[model samples]
Target: MGSNPAAPIEVHDLTVAYRKKPVLWDIDFELPEGRLIGLVGPNGAGKSTLIKAIMGLMPLLSGYVRVYGQPLEDRRELVGYVPQRESVDWDFPVDALDVVTMGRYGRMGLFTRPSKEDYEIAMACLDKVGMADYAKRQISQLSGGQQQRVFLARALTQDASIYLMDEPFAGVDAATEKAIIELLKELKSKQKTVLVVHHDLNTAEEYFDWLMLLNMRLVKFGETRDVFTQENLRMTYGGKLHLLSEAAEKVARQ
Candidate 1:
């Protein structure tokens, strides 16, 4: 394997399965540092599965993932993950600030609590996402877009070099979407790499500098202008292997 020290994320022959059925097969790609990347594919395309595998949240059937030329476990602190907003329990009794402060928990050992400085850092993140005023509001009280911004703020507080966000634009207002794109640009300017799981093909070209096209595997990964063409998108969303389709369907049914 060519280990480029500058690449933020490197996957080699990665495979993941649910039960006995494969979800992602023989996936391999390296994400360049300091770019805003859009990971696009049709539903059930294993986009989120890929992010989950990278975060070690899901078991991998085979293959390995590296972060900054080292095993993922060794550089876990350098990776920040923003899961889908829907995956969270909104009703839990926590304000926006509390949620953001939780990001510091990884840096803070189990026995230590967040200090005043940590709270300041969380507030700064909230301000960066334009949610500083909502710090005291209950998470459930925020609008969909505001909730998403809060999540972004939480991820920002991690101060990670690389970020993996799953569908950050889903269910967000246009204003929130624009804000997120700006935040991504800011991250890129700071030499941080961000990979966003995005579904809207129309906005995909406009938002990202790099693109990762996946359909149960890596279809193409390169600069947006080169990889986001009609042919590659067709290959991603079009005809699938009957057996793989059937397996995915069966897994979904369960």
Candidate 2:
């Protein structure tokens, strides 16, 4: 275990299951602060499950998760999460600004409305993501990339020390992908820790300083240079040849 009490995230003996079928088993890792980390694995390998368990959004079958050396409940305000785009209900009645303002709910009391400062902050975040012009647009009316940007702005409004995002780049134009990565780098410059669920093996090392290769277990977790080896990729993907070749070429190019 890390001796640093302020490690961004720590999980010990963590396990989670669905319908009595284990998805994550005895997962354990302690993350350092101020880095962009990527969680990569094959589909159904429990990548999203791990993030949910860490956020306390799922019932853990056993073990525990700690954030900044405290239980998630005590550190809720310090963490922010952006769920997968597929998991969100874009049809719900809300405008872009309204969605971003919801991020401030954590700082509010029950039944309290957002104050002026909260709206200001939300607008600022929206502007940061280049969605300020669409503040009044309905969420469902926006393009996929625009919707994703709105969600990222919402996470930014929380101003959290740690942010966990699930597949933020799953589907988007190249410009949007580039913009999101740039925003993530900005967060890193502020010494914020970010863990992203990434699907593209070819870009994993290019995007993150640390890589966590998971396949229903903690296959490998460490600096990207050390953990992005061929053996680790094979273990994580069960010898998927094409992906391996692509990743190898990416590494060679770098």
For TM-score, the strongest prediction is 2
Regions more than 4 Å wrong, model 1: 239-254
User: Over the stretch 1-254, how does candidate 1's per-residue lDDT look in tens digits?
Assistant: 26686579998899999999999999988888788999998889899999999999999999999998899989988999999999989999999999999998989877999999999999999999999999999999999999999999999999999999999998888789889989998999999999999977777898999999998989999999999776777788765556435644664454
Alpha-carbon TM-score of each model against the true structure:
0.92, 0.94
Question: Which ranges of candidate 2 are over 4 A from the true structure?
Answer: 240-254
TM-score (C-alpha, index-matched) for candidate 1:
0.92
Q: Against the correct fold, how does model 2 do in TM-score?
A: 0.94
How would you encode candidate 2's per-residue C-alpha lDDT over 7-54 as one tens digit per residue? Answer: 889898999999989999999899989999999988889999999999
Give the clashing pairs for model 2: none
